[model samples]
Target: MPRAVTLIRSTALSDVAEYAYAATAPADARLIFLAGACPLNEDGSTAAVGDYAGQAAKAVENMRTALGAAGAGLDDVISTRVLVASARQEDLVTAWKVVRNAFGDHDVPSTLLGVTVLGYADQLVEIEGVAAVLDS
Candidate 1:
């Protein structure tokens, strides 16, 4: 099946960033707005305490599961916002590296943020995503 999502890269924009600068989905596509996927295990505990990279990986894994349940996948994702609970740029970069590697060549548009705290105890990372899929 053909994907509805299209990632846009611009020659005018700097190519230093790992992901595309923008993306779009056709009007007929089904939009999937996923909740923030936290670094939590199935049992409700945080998966990686005090480990930014590990927590980011777990969050990406959870995001993938959520997308699959919604009849989408990483390739169908149009954009994402990654939240890391930290005041340090290094911490945010650590989390972003994991997420970027997870997406690989799909490289959807993304925003990385560093916040003071997250919802769950010992939670270090959360990923929010929007995916579009054609349903025909």
Candidate 2:
């Protein structure tokens, strides 16, 4: 099996991301798109209300569960879209910190969006991801 890893960078953007990703990955690779995951606990209740950090953590955990169902993990994620209800810079930074800690050294391509509200009344954050299953 052969694998390739590419890190896109540009002076215009501090974060690493390609202007455009490869239209098609290698043959035999399986692609997976997880649904938007919210900060809901296993009991079907919001994990944290008005707490970006806690919501971010729970959202990531939900994302992991969705990825696992598709035979993928956090490391396999190629891209992510994070949604936060608050547009405040401090709130955004705090949520991003949680995501960064979860990803650690792997800086997966991501887009963070700040919105005025979400589907749930108490939900503060949501996360979704795309992953590729490598051929063994």
Candidate 3:
């Protein structure tokens, strides 16, 4: 069996998200599209308020849960899209740190965007991912 890898590249966007991603897998392979995940707790309440680090952590955790639901893990994640409410340099840096820490040794192709706002007024960050199920 052959494994597929995600591709990342520098883009014209801000320094935070220069990496662009594409899905490249066998035609017969199974692919999963995860919905946009926000920094919300299990109880459907916002996890962090005005805390970039905390919101980032929760967003990453939510991404992990989404991947698991698709029968995949962080290692199987091919691409990720991160949305940050604040475009401040400091906030971007802090969010990146949280994401990098969550991935640890597994680094997948990712894109980070600085947005003016998110779905929830308290949400500071949102994360979405794509994964591929391994062949049995």
CA shift of 48, model 2, Å: 1.3
Task: Write down the TM-score of every candidate.
Answer: 0.98, 0.83, 0.81
- The TM-score between candidate 3 and the true structure equals 0.81
TM-score of 1: 0.98
Best by TM-score: 1
Q: Any idea how many clashes model 3 has?
A: 0
Judged by whole-model lDDT over C-alpha atoms, candidate 2 comes out at 0.77
| Clashing pairs for predicted structure model 1, backbone only | none
Candidate 1 lDDT tens digits, 9-128: 999999999999999999999999999999999999999799999999999999999999999899999999999999999999999999999999999999999999999999989999
Q: List model 3 lDDT by residue over 73-112, tens digit each.
A: 7766778778888869789778978986787655667777
Clashing pairs in 3: none
For residues 17-58, what per-residue lDDT tens digits would candidate 2 score against the true structure?
422232234556788888888999888889888799999999
Candidate 1 overall Cα lDDT vs. reference? 0.95
Give the CA lDDT, 0 to 100, for residue 113 in model 2: 86
Put the candidates in lDDT order, highest first.
1, 2, 3
